[model samples]
Target: MNDVPVAVAAMPSAEGTAVARAAAVVGGPPAVRCTGLARRFGRRWAFSRVDLEVAAGARLLIMGANGSGKTTLLKVISTLIPPSLGAVQIFGHDAGADPAAARARLHLLSHSAGLYEDLSGADNLLVLSRLLGRPLVDPVALLARVGLAPRPEPVRTYSAGMRKRLQLAALLLKDPPLTLLDEPFAALDPAGCGAVEALISGLSGTVIVASHQVGRAARLCDHALLMHEGAARWQGPAARAVEAYTALHGIDNADGGG
Candidate 1:
């Protein structure tokens, strides 16, 4: 791990205690930390006074109904959107001010492919690889690594799971230390879900994933967050959260409490 290259992206929680802890104990900083994090649209509050921390090798699962500010929180942590209040730092770099630096080590995956549908898989990899200024890897090989065949069809023809695998390949190639995943299980078959979950588990980084599937969340995370109305109603072990959540709000029902 000593030879592992430093990340080029902005790290979101590499400062304060996290930095000291990471540097002293192992190889990198804690995965993420959000302190008093909030977002507001005029008088409306998307979220407020949120505080959380994740350690190296930690996986955090976030669960919430729609409009609960789940995506908002992820965006704020990933440097994609600025918080109306509070600060986010990665590896001691300011995510808002030094996004490029933070992004050097950060990987974020969402429903959007973030690929050029008009281009080949190789082309997509080459483009983003160049953009990130990392070592250029063979695109065909990358596709194969993700279990996609080297076909001539444009990325537009890829199935949802294939696209997800491609995006996952890109993240894997980067070997980033911090990853943010949003609803990665959508449209995936049971086998596909297992594949994705295994890939996530194998990634040697700190991961934060947002998903509605309590089963996957429980398997992939050391802890889980129950977000409702833009705040965390409960935060603790993934299994405990699942049990508590089931008790508080059954699989058939939807509300916030346990």
Candidate 2:
């Protein structure tokens, strides 16, 4: 049997060094920029007065409790939902002004699997690849790369963890400059979790992840942004950011799972 790829290894120790190396290798403009970014639903705001910048090849983690706008912020950045106020730019393209171009540079993996229940995993990827006007990739091969054995069953028959792997395989079809992940580790099994950590560590571009798993995030990311009540409570290096988040939540650093 072939060995698992380094990108899919689930070891806790695999986080910092690999991600830091990727961050150090690249420079120049920020891959993602949000200025005074805010989002609202009717009379309520999802997130407001948010300013964020992620340098090329950097790994950034977004930490917050439920309803703290982690998901909302990611949606705005991915152009999936429009910001109620302020501006967003991806690779210098104004998200509001040229959403099409901006979106092309980003791949968002949100809570929803975004797959067809009745379709086989490979078929789902094929449809998306066609929609993007990109050449098709062998979905089975891609699934194997993510630590999943390729199967012919419909996506609806797969467990939550399996679905996540299918979604990730779809992502590997494109080489987007920025990847936005919301709660990537949720519902994953031990192996599944490791696969995600390894993939993030191996990515060559910028990444922004919103996860409540502070310890895992801190390990996988070099920078961190903490949000509370729809506002940025803290932002900076992962160590200090982890400290700030722990201080607010009154939790010990070790309790933030890896």
Candidate 3:
């Protein structure tokens, strides 16, 4: 792990410290910049010609119908997959030219829990800490912070909401400069949703969330982008997200699942 390029050294051991560290870099180049970003799978384009800029410390909400390319856009920004056309810059670092630098400053919490089902929640954090070349500071406290209780049972026994909470705990441990979340509000109870909202509110760095829970997500975000058929249909203040989405589709209820 000593050779790992991830910036785990001197990483914040607590959420408060992480917030403070993120605040120190609040103003600079845009946290994320996409120029003509597009992704294609065989014959169909998942998303195309998507150009956007997210400022540091901004919370952006991405709303669109199912298969409208919200997840694909996030994957490209996270550098998990390359764009068929276009470039992505994370805090001024080109993702294509220098992916490692971009990755070190961001964390992507995708739809999958990305956890080891055979490992306990605490053990999962331990492994991640070692992989990032950091010491396991306090998994118990971290789990609690995400509204998860310490358990001896492996992650395979955890519920969907519990798994989401654990994934959030892992994100806090990294405390990257940019955070990308895909359907973060899915599979959570009211309490779990509240916990997620609180955590997002506390983050001082850039945050991008792709979710179908338009009403709730819009409130937490400062900026909004609506995608339709592989293109950006609208981009503006979060307050008008529902209106923009409604006007495009003529659907009064944008709260439906994606």
Candidate 4:
């Protein structure tokens, strides 16, 4: 066997160092970070003091009943609404100071379909993709992926579930690194629900899902944050977090009964 040259072996390769640095950045930084996050509408606080950190590729489920601030929190994280207090960092970009950069890395799907009612499903997605500077794609393919047939009629004529699927297809076309989904399973038939779940399971980026379907959402998520009355009750592994939320909800009901 030939002996390797000592000079060559001793030198540190620039490419190796660069790769290591990239890995360090990806592994070290949390994909989403919130500190002392609070949002209010008039005198009512939607959520308060919500400190959270989620790494890249994490599936985080926000569990709560109605009026629990799940939608509000997701809106704040997505930079759709400014926080009343504290800070949010998405992929290390400050949402308050650098909303454009943060938004570039995030996609939000609210309860509303957020589509142009007058436009056809394909047209709506095409318009958004162009506006967002995403690659122009065949809307029919995307619609098919979401289990919606290509139709010429306006989205105004679509059923609730069809509209929801159309919106999902549009966002999937954007394919941002961070996704915020508010009640993804709502307004879906059994087949539509299965399609959404499958899509979520296939995603490799970070996801924050706000849903009242605790059991189903918990199954899809690795981590969970349970909220009640605009406050987080527990944040941890999904199963335990669900248990904590159930126990806390029960306690609140018992107190009310008394």
Candidate 5:
């Protein structure tokens, strides 16, 4: 089996670490705030009347079954789509009124890798950096940080795990303060999963992960939100959220271990 290379023990830079420490000490507005948030496609409500608040430097786990609106909630918070009702704020900036500001402060890793299939992995990062109006940082270093070697081959030939690694590199390049990850553990091997978990553990900014890998993800998070039928069923300690999820679903083992 060809496993993707992952720098499992990679550490953030001194500047990154300082920024995280400062944010924690300053104690400013919540990193993410949503009031009566809702989204709809025609007549079907993807999610409705959801209220959420995540403090700075907190890790939040969003758990739900398929079609439970986990992806939709992340999208709205990321400013990729507008909420049909209510409002969203990122770092105290109203997402609807100031989308650019909100977007500048957050990074969203969705189901799609969002890479240019025809471009090399390095080139993809460079292009994205340019498009986002960020400085031209070293793509090779970014790729290396994510345990992906610089390759001349276009992303079209890369494996699913490789693409995911490249996406991670992109996330590093942006280095946004608020990160929204949707199913980050999917399409990854044990090593890749471990690498992702490590990366999340090191993030100093606010993180919200939507995942089904309950056992591993919950432990890494300080808070958890459980979604059921397009609504938030529970929100509190990560362990209790896991218990509520398992009890509601009647599962003996949610993800094998907590």
Candidate 6:
């Protein structure tokens, strides 16, 4: 197959370190940048007046209600959907101007399992590996890493947890610079959640996980961004972010399912 020259994000200097943009005034490394981000379905503004910056290798968690623009904000950042009224910059490159370069390092795992039920777990992973333009890793090892050890069965026969884990294995491929996990913990067993948390604990790179699971996010992330009606209300440390959310919403059930 012809390796079409897919432009990679201009490699950042200083050994994988991104430009740190703590303040909007001075420029620095940015994994994600949003200015005046707004989305409108019709007359209603989903969100507006949102500006945010995140440095390299920071794991970000988005906290909000089901319809409060958490997913919308993620979509815009991942370049899946365009913001109607805002400009987004990812990895120091303009999202609208050079999305391809940004997307090379971007991986978005949607709410649904983007796996083929008809194909076996190995086949699904191999297909993704080819698209990533990299050699596929050991399927059995990948499956075992995610606790799906007994392999070589049709994916359609697998349980929802198994499928989700398989999708996660594929997501780990390409070593994407930015990873977006939407409700990543949905439909996992207690053991699986703990395993995933352990796996994500020291994960190196930029990540944005949109979920209402504040407790999990607190343990798993370094930074947290709160979105309400499509705008950023607060952004800071994980613990403080959780505290702010507890004050606004409540501590009850902030962990989400189970």
What tens digits encode model 1's per-residue C-alpha lDDT throughout 1-258? 111111212223221111211222255555666667889888998877777766665667787766778888888888888999887777667787888888887888887888899987777888888887777757787778778888778899889988998888888778788889988787888777877877887776677888767665556666678787877778766656566566656674322211
Error of 2 at 230 (Å): 0.6
Please rank every candidate by lDDT, starting with the best: 3, 5, 2, 4, 1, 6
lDDT scores of the candidates, listed in order? 0.72, 0.78, 0.82, 0.76, 0.79, 0.71
Candidate 3 lDDT trough over 10 residues, lowest sum? 1-10
lDDT of 6 by residue, 1-258 (tens): 221111112223222222331222235457777777778778887777767766666677788877888877788888888889878888788989998988887888777778788888988888888877888758778767777775677798988778777877887766677788887787888877776666555355777788888777666666677776666677666657667777778656676653
Error (Å) of candidate 3 at residue 91 is 0.8
Backbone clash pairs for candidate 6 read 19-28, 19-29, 20-29
Which candidate wins on lDDT?
A: 3
- Candidate 6 regions exceeding 4 Å error are 1-28
- For all predicted structures, in order, the TM-scores are 0.83, 0.88, 0.88, 0.85, 0.88, 0.84
Q: What stretches of model 5 exceed 4 Å from their correct place? A: 1-27, 256-258
Instruction: Please state every model's RMSD to the true fold in angstroms.
Output: 8.4, 8.1, 8.2, 12.1, 8.6, 8.5
For residue 61, model 3's alpha carbon misses the true position, in angstroms, by 0.8
In model 2, what are the clashing residue pairs, if there are any? 7-198, 10-194
Per-residue lDDT, model 4, residue 42, is: 100
Candidate 4: C-alpha lDDT = 0.76
Which residue window of length 10 is worst by lDDT in model 1? 1-10
lDDT per residue as tens, model 4, 20-121:
111113445577888888899999999887888777666677888889999999999999999999899998999989999999998999988889999999
